[model samples]
Target: MNYRIEWKQILKNKEKVQCSSDWISAESAIQLGEELERNGKVTDLYFYDEMGVSWNMKEMRKLLLEIEEEPHDITLYFDGGFQKETYQAGLGAVIFYHQGKKKYRIRANNLFNEMETNNEAEYAALYFALGILEELGVEYKTCEIKGDSQVVLKQLEGEWPCYEEVLNRWLDRIEEKINKMGIRPRYTVISRKDNKEADKLATQALEGKEIYAKTIIL
Candidate 1:
């Protein structure tokens, strides 16, 4: 997670002024907060996360410890494939996260029937990934979501306007789940070549092969 440090600093002429640092990692914020305390001129030190939630020094320290034992630092990739002839849609999701000191990756896929278009399938794939995050007990954390579908990712980021009623419904559902989970999502678009893992998984699902696996990585 990333946060900005905000505090009140006392100037030489007995003036008090507010100061803040750029968004930085939690560890770096803590280190800088401690150093600011040692200077004895900084007061009301606090950390503000991307969601605009504020945390005091004590609270921030405790939160870091608590989060270390849970699933945090998440990155998810998703893709969808649709077969027009069969009206089947295949969804795939790949998740990477850390729990304590171990790093883990999860790969999951599902197949659905009667999907209208590949765009709708793409939206469904992302929604499927959110379910995996929920099952992993990931909440109130920032997740970097990556995908190759420009329509899906851009619409989610509010960069593109979605006109299809069906797609709008999917958008609402995805946003609802994200808000309930307190997930701060950072969306990124990548090339199809870069999304091969999720693409392959989606392809497999379309071929009647389902997959679900979790493994540790170095």
Candidate 2:
């Protein structure tokens, strides 16, 4: 997670002024906050996360310790493929996260028989990934979401307007789930080549091969 340090600083002329630093990592914010406290000139020190939630030095330290045992530094990759011939859709999701000192990767895929379009499938794949995150107890954390579907990513980012009612419904469902899970998502569009892993998983699902695996990366 990232935070900005905000506090009141006492100037040499006995003037009190508010000061805030640029957004930085939680660890860095804590380190800097401690150093500022040692100077004895800084007061009301606090850190605010991207969600605009503020935390005091004591609260932040305790929260950091708790977060270390859960999932953090998360990156999710998702893709979906639809076959018009049979109205079948395959959804794939891959998640990478840090728990304590270890890094882990999870791969999962599913097949559905009633998808209307590939765009809908793409949205479903992202929703499926969110379910995985919830099962892993990920909450109140930033997640970097990557996918190759321009329509899905752009629409989610509000860069492109979604005119289809079906797609809008999917968008609503996805947003509702995200809010309920307290997930902060950063969406990125990547080339199909760069998303080969997720693409392959979707393809495997279409071939009737299912997979759900998690492994330690470091």
Candidate 3:
């Protein structure tokens, strides 16, 4: 989590000015707000999240602390494999998160039929991971969404033109869902080696194995 420090330079022996810090981690902002309040010179402290919602010093501090007690700074990795012979798609996702000083990982996989292309399966895997994030009550935060598929990455980043109607619709749906969730996604393209866990999960799912595990990293 990152935040910008802002002072309202009032010139009345105190800082007075509306500081619009952009892309700040809400948790960090709350801590800064608390420190400012302790100065006694701060007439008002406001913490603005990425969603533009304002939080008072006390509320912001409490929320930040509570979030600290909970889990934050989530990373999700997703991948999919489509078997051309059977038209079966295998999906996999790995979620890494932090709670207090602890780190956790959640692994999941699924198998589905009816997907026409590997690309569509790739999109499905990402969408599935987001659904899990929503269930965990982690939204409106800075998150990294990664995949090994260059096609998926380029298409999502808008670097490549998507002419297929099916892919275009999937892309639009993803954009809409992301906006509604207020997520700031940092998309990255990783090598297949780095994405092996997810790849293996998908393969396992395709072989009729159910994979679901969550573990804490010591």
Which is the winner by TM-score between candidate 2 and candidate 3?
2
Model 3 regions more than 4 Å off? 9-28, 36-44, 69-71
Give the poorly placed runs of model 2, Cα more than 4 Å off. none
Q: For candidate 2, lDDT tens digit of each residue in 12-35?
A: 997999999999988999999999
On residues 1-218, what C-alpha lDDT tens digit does candidate 3 reach at each position? 45555556455755466655555677656656666667666655666655556667767667777877765788889999999999999999999999887999999999988889999999888888888887777767778899998887799888988888888887888888788777888899999999999999899989999898999999
Q: Evaluate model 3: give its TM-score.
A: 0.82
Compared with the true structure, what per-residue lDDT tens digits does model 1 show for residues 60-137?
999888988999889999999999999899999999999998999999999988899999999999999999999989
Residue 32 lDDT in candidate 3: 65
Q: What TM-score would every model get versus the actual structure?
A: 0.95, 0.95, 0.82
Q: Give the clash total for candidate 3.
A: 7
lDDT of 3: 0.81
As for lDDT, the candidate ahead, 1 or 2, is 1
**Cα RMSD to the true fold for all candidates:** 1.3, 1.3, 3.0
Q: Rank by lDDT, descending? A: 1, 2, 3
TM-score of 1: 0.95
